[model samples]
Target: MSASVKSPRDPSTSFDDDVWPDSTDVLIMGGGPVGLSCAIMLAQRGVDVLLVERRDFVFRFPRAHLLNPRTMEAFHDMGVAGDIYGATPAHDRWRKAAWYTTATGPGRFDGMKIGDVPAWGGGPDAERYRSSSPRAFANMPQLRLDPLIHRHALAAAPGRIRSRQEVVAIEQDSESAVVSVRDVVTGELRTVRARYVIAADGGRDSADLLGIELEGPRDMREVVNYHVSMDLSAWSEPDALLGHFLHPAGGARRRGTIQALGPTHYNRDSEEWLVSVAAWMVEGDPDDEAALFASIRRMLGLADDHEITMHSMTRWSYHGLVAKQFRDRRVFLVGDAAHKHPPTGGLGLNSGIQDAQNLCWKLAAVLDGQAPDGLLDSYQAERRPVVAWYTAHSLENANRHPPIAEALGFCDDEAAGFRGLEVFVSETPEGEAMRARVAAEVAHNAHDYSQLGVEAGYHYWAGALVPDGTPVPGDPSDPVTFHATSRPGHHLPHVWLDSATGGDGGSVSAHDLIAAAGLTLLTSESAAPRWRAAVAAASGNMPITVVAIADDDAAWTAVRQIDDDGALLVRPDRKVAWRAARLPADPDAELTAALETILRGGDAPAGDPAEPYLRRIRAAANVLVR
Candidate 1:
């Protein structure tokens, strides 16, 4: 197969909704990594979901190889991170990404040590991630990962995932969305009425139906990817780990320029590999298979006798686009349908997974009548800005690569010319200076690998969150370094603490204590009974659980940064919704008011002059009791 292979039919061009044959709380329109993730998240909350995909089976092309720590955390919450980890290549072999001139011999470039273990997050930063969450980043290509995600999603909600099913048309009213779907295998058409339609359909028809445009640059660059399987053990040292292959400029056998992708295979010991040739790095048509093969062979410095089986070759244009709106009435867009970015920072799939995590719980809450419908609007308000930041960061990273090319003597500087391989391989003074410059450039590129800040430090403001009038100092827009904080709207900082179970019990992550469905309240040991009493007084009215850490837990206290007598309200997505530095004099009144405001989507109640907020709260309580 090659890049010219056609995709499956468009699933949102026609509507024949004459017969209604199905109904579900959520109708997921795509079963890629993000759709599967949305299904798992919703199913775990006991939300009835139907996931449909146009493709009959999972695609085998390897894409999005790096699953960042934040993505792994979502998998951990879904209880499937371990399964994903088992499928990934060994971390020790793939974590340290470096640049090599060729696959064989002593062609290692000096200062080519781009970063340490967890190529996405280097040594010290990776250690910080370990302390915060149980999951670590891993390198598992989409070909292997999709099936695992599919299996887990199926297991989470049996008989709900439907393959070869395409959604052809969607129309939504105030109450529900009616979708017309066609069975790809049988040419059968059916109608489904879903309370909400989640369009994770990979940036195609669904986005157009909702009149949403992916607004940004789509022609940043073009690149050709070659998926192959070949034995390269002769070129690697025993137990050797290989990552990025930088085929520097000017080699006798080289056809223009090419670079082999590392981390696509299990390791150098494995036969599976995916090599890429960026169009910006070369001067020939990337779609030409013969030219691509010549470049690959030249980059490998291998003999024609070597065997390499080609699986597929595909050309993709790099993009940095996000949908104009993530939601439209009863339909919502997620995953690639919501945003698209180049793979430079590996943010695309991970951001989509997190988007699913964020929206699913809110949907579950609204569908279950635990929270008002207005809460749904916060999804766009919170996610759009964060995704926009990620988009900019990825584009910046892609632009940064040209500087590396310039340092390696490949740019259009006629005065410098092509230095050839000798600059990186030879030990002469000129070679040593080139290595130093390359090393300095590599050091400047550290943000690409050590992006702990981007992985964990995102915060939400003005949506589904109540500010306590405390000003939180702003950090850098990019992920240079992470600052741990439990401020309102920030994610709850992770800390290890002794279980409130007793004096001689095991320890648990503060993250582990958050409610999977409702709001969670954290208080000091002395205020436990008061908070519990306040919650009980408001019982049947609000969904909340109270946990009090012993005042003596210094580590937990410092990380949370809250006074012993204060309280912190955590949302289902593990973000701080509100916090009180100290107990309010009227805890019950304060707690009731907060719950009412949050449930109304962080707005005061409407239309009633007689205690509208209180009246709505009572009405919801009465409904719950009924």
Candidate 2:
């Protein structure tokens, strides 16, 4: 999985359409994390998929530094969460973020703690809540992680993921998409026909090709990132990534260096550095290396004798944008292709990965004849709002400025300032209330996955798959915010339960339980008989698990109460397709209606054996060729 490994397939080689299958179930246009996740999900479901990437190999950029809990859950489902955990470099989970008046200014604030939770017990369930099993936010750089994902995708489907294949054109009719790709290294063109095409080509290329416009602020200022090697033990504090070198007088613009890269472990050999510096613009010849070198030297407090090694220089603009639509006909967009946000929150890559996961299961269900054709529209319905939410939130996070010290009631009068400090810390109710409010605000600011359930918890609220009731307030369209309560259409809350009901209290992880059940129908034991009977009627037609749980756990209890009769039917993609107090007598018919409502575009439901729809589509294509 080294970054230097080249593509195994020769550029001169063209996959012979006559020798192989004439069409693919899905064509994925980027081999990055998003596309790779899509490929893995499809291949896992036994779908014929073709994945192409313009890059010669896996990503080497130092982007996407953290993996939140929701993403960990996704990796768990993929069976690679452990591999990712093992590969990540060991580092302190709780680190500080420093902010300065300016990029070069002296530090105005100390370390600000982000995310940390205290342990309550020791077990898988405990780990799920407290242990950071999948890492709520880990510091492993994407340069090291992307290769692992790429390898996993290729391993998931041998001879499926094609590297160095640049997609030049995509055309789709009502039934299939034809894509033209050129081997970037060999200059050979090949046509691939697929039932669906996913464009993960980021914003620049795929957006333009699809005639999609990105509406948002462009880069008003250029930020330069440098990966460098240096010894900062003399001045740098441990675990401090941002160091501000404020102006001596404190009234002028401050400038400082942002630590963009760090060692996975504390090993001296493993130690590397990524520094970012920003300014309005470089004066006196923009290309002046001396100016850049001087900025680094001043920021780092470097001495004349200090040795330095620079790895790479990258320039990025602060572009915040979302595509008008994630899909146009058979072609769909995900990840950076659908949206781009400021990297301040490290949500871009993680959000993109979620996008892939959301789309993958629906695509698999449709292609595998498990779900109807209309099910595909829900992909856009559910994910587009998420992109918009994260983009706006990320922009807000980027723009947030630390509270000025003066705002803490400190005054110019030295005597008055001391009195103010005493009152602020002492028995004054106002002072105590202010302090508590500030602390609570800071804790609230800590980005927790409570909102993740919203992002990942998204349910289809539009098109044929629209859920019942007035769209749940803040359903998929609302901005993501941390809320402990589980709302309808939100990600099923993570809770540990006693897996062994008859014996002593033994707990199992929520993720493990869900995976074991395959497709979980969470409802009370009282409803199990009816649900089981309903599922039995559709026995040969659908494959799902009926999980009956007591209304003891808080989240599930709330879901049960609000959903009525404690019965909720969850799709394989972990979305709630239908929920009711009891299954109808004709359970198969009711289930069919729900499925058709979501997947059939209000057209009359398909007759028995939904397999014919998929078969007919493919068979008709073959007839056209004949």
Candidate 3:
């Protein structure tokens, strides 16, 4: 697990089709980052999983970017964190999210400088961000991210991934789901049966085949992505990764975005970039390369002599949609198949990664006969609402764009816009006022890039979790705040603890204890023996383990929120399944009952998980006090 890395196998590498297996424990469709992640983590958990992707390899275009810290923690659990970290530019290279009037200046009075803000793991909140988790964020695009995830999936189970094979139809009965797959090149069909199916086909092809109906808007907005190789070092900021180029004549409604697609080395010096613009109603042809080039030159202030090489211009839709439900008997929807979002907050891919993480363990438990079939119901209960909040938050982030443009005087009124633009960077009192206004607005955009609470401290209720009757902790409504607690149905607060009470013990995050991929019973040293005895007597050979924190370990002692004899039962996904304030009269029976409740399916607290978060989403998105 050191920094040393082994070359991962390209997902395009062929698996033996001559001996296609007709059965698997889990069949994952779509080999994008989410599907590949599912395959890797499920295989790591000893599940018989097979992955099928229509494309021979992952698309090279930079699609989803900015793997948030929460996703990185999940990636760490999947054992691909090291590779993910190794594959990207340094966190500092692309840590600044800067805004500008245009790619070039209109005046010498800070003309191009609208304002600046730190992104990812930078700025005033950096320490607070690091305090919650052991892992940091990554800025690699999906084009580079997919193969790293795929490599681990292949390494975990060779011959498990089949490319160029597409799922045609799925029929589920009482036992397993029968899937009809077609080999794209040969036009031959293959039949496979699986206890569970993960539809990661981005919802386009697989949702209908499985008789699933999607709710929410479709084709909400059009975003054109231009992949081009250009030298932009002249106006590029040293520490910025995303450059917001608002047109000098363009209003608050329209602005151009430039994202660095660093192939290698530093992102500030990346040779390739993804330039995009959004339009509710476009006038010209959607694929007008000439118009796009003219816009790019206008945004970047490219000279006629400067050569611009256009690689490809992709026109994609921005829809804020979520599936009605995640579970359809034995079939589950994940990734784009489950929901889609506007690419403002970078929550789409991260949400999908977590969806797979939440479901795989439950699947393993049921397949191993450790949990009842009812456990599967928790998938939608626990995951969908989080996606709902992400959808709302992403829209909120998208909406932040216009206000920033307005502050910079990018408007339709020609004279008013020019006057406001001139005063924005002027040295007079009016100029100072405009400068301050733009600065404050640009800083507010931090919620789009560095909103820690939504990504890491997402609150969950119901489904697989056994919620103790307690009020929700911290500011659940604040999208920018995260407070670590050990309450049941909540993510276990992370704290570094020593292996032994002696001062010489090795340090590790609380997450490392659950590395074995099962329910972990965390108890203090004084209570360890009793918890161990209880687990031994009532585990029923389930994949449960008990760990004791030393009495001398202050970190665990502070966050546990339980008595010396109490314990917390954590699911494989790292959420607290149950909490015992103190030793039960019959520890064995108490432990057994908790397991039965979780495995047999317990009713979550009554409420729509999206309601409270939606209220917070509607609230002003400001930097919360950590």
Candidate 4:
């Protein structure tokens, strides 16, 4: 049968002003995307969950613009990606990362176009992105994404989210744990207990409650975001996702960048924007509003009186901090509580959503008596390596920026001026050399922009999945390329499957065939009869679905890494738990052994040997930790 497509529903549930529950099956701290994702994912699995947030309202900061394909695929499974896709701007509205000497006015430089490249996973590379996954990277910011996720979370778990509530205290033993949550609005205290606690609190306190130390660099550097609104429709601005306004004297701190907020056009409709500039440029002892206005005008090459409205000025730091351990007894850290990264790669949020996805299923299985406590340990084993690699990756991306200035012949302090840029763009031989150098540097920096491998190709070397002992497919070291395979511990390769008889005539992603809350056994027609019978016999109290390929799904079967008479078992999170290359003589016994290894942690690592490599990766980062 074709995979069933779930229709969207109204998230009609409300939790504001509702009384607190004394207990739940799961307690999720923090109401950011990660916590909400945890609540939604867990509730859909029939688990009672309570999500707590310290803020009284959904945060409106317009941060984290890129939703990578892997994160989008997970959101698609949760039923919220459709609405996000519908609301996103068209491709042309945010396709390029174009650099400029300035946007307009040409006060110091003649508004020369420095360079251009495709941003995110679109434009000339669109096919590469499309072929890798079923979804596109949405250039949706949190100002739009968070509220939608909050609404879906309400629907997924009605009367379960409590804003203006914070986890003040937490203590856990082997049996159950207690968390003291305080109502920030009413100054009232409430106590709740849960079988498990997830600290997705974005480095607020839950990790502190467990006394977990953050390993690696602390404060790398500081940058300021100026949320301003202006009418740039009169300027000669072209389409771009991000506009890099460059000038040699600007230094790394003063080089300005503009992020498109969007409504079909960059200048005509993206009236609001977030600007990155040096903190010192806008900082003054007496608060020089006139000078600040001038600095903004100079950055955009606008005249002195350009009528820009300043909404908010936020100053934040970049860090490469990872919690010493993600799991401690019954409390597990998810999202920022577990790891922090610089925004250079726009991966902080994408990795957080994936963290929730990885953790919630293991939680559901254990709570339902379907898995062992040892299975929970796999969360750290699978995810910590990713956390370490990304921390280094993001810091490397941040360091890649200043070299662009150098490549444009900004080496000497005296030569770093508008005249230097003019000569560099000339048709002279010196200009050609400078252009080549700039292109090489920009291409190097582009790794941060289109890291499809880091986004999708990441896998576990030591986790819950039963390894086939074959070498792990794909270059785990390459952050730009993704190699699809059905190796255990890797995401099941995505392929469109034709419908089975007595089913809908449409084709769907093989990933969609797996249930959100169960095990799914995918077998070919040649192996269908025994696999179905074996699943029926072995499913017992667990939710397991059996799907037989329609014999013509060459695309789907080719990536299975299994024989026509073999089968693959997919977990609730769509991870391939085990694969049988060929049908065994006793089908029931084979299926039973696979489930035992997966759910019971039959072949998981005995210790955290991956940590030494992770520590080395962290130490090698070019980050400045205070």
Candidate 2 C-alpha lDDT tens digits along 1-626: 01111122212123442233457888888877888887777777666788888887746566666676667677777776787767554444224443322231233321222222211111122333342222343446777777877888777776778888888888878889988888888898889899999888785457767898765555634677767776655443444443433322222222334554555533223356666665532335435665665666655555545666766667787666766677888888999998876665567888888887777777766665656667677666666655665666665544332222232343345445345445545688988865665445333323322234333444433433425554454443233332332333445555555432323545654434343212455666676676666666652333566777764555356434343344555555455556554555676677656655655532332332222222332332232210
Instruction: Give Cα distance to truth, residue 533, candidate 2, Å.
Output: 0.9
lDDT of each: 0.70, 0.56, 0.77, 0.75
- TM-scores for all candidates? 0.85, 0.75, 0.92, 0.92
Q: What shift in Å separates residue 118 of candidate 2 from its native position after superposition? A: 12
Whole-model alpha-carbon lDDT for candidate 2: 0.56
Provide the lowest-lDDT 10-residue window in model 3.
Answer: 1-10
| Candidate 3 accuracy as TM-score | 0.92
Off by over 4 Å in 1: 1-21, 90-93, 105-118, 234-242, 247-265, 280-289, 413-434, 499-506, 539-541, 603-626
Clashing pairs in 1: none
TM-score: the better of candidates 1 and 3: 3
- Model 4: lowest-lDDT 10 consecutive positions: 1-10
| Candidate 3 Cα errors over 4 Å, as ranges | 1-15, 91-93, 105-111, 265-267, 279-285, 498-506, 611-626
Write down the lDDT that model 4 would get: 0.75
Quantify how close model 1 is to the true structure by its C-alpha RMSD in Å. Answer: 11.2
TM-score computed on alpha carbons, candidate 1: 0.85
User: What are the root-mean-square deviations of the candidates from the true structure over C-alphas?
Assistant: 11.2, 11.2, 5.1, 3.5
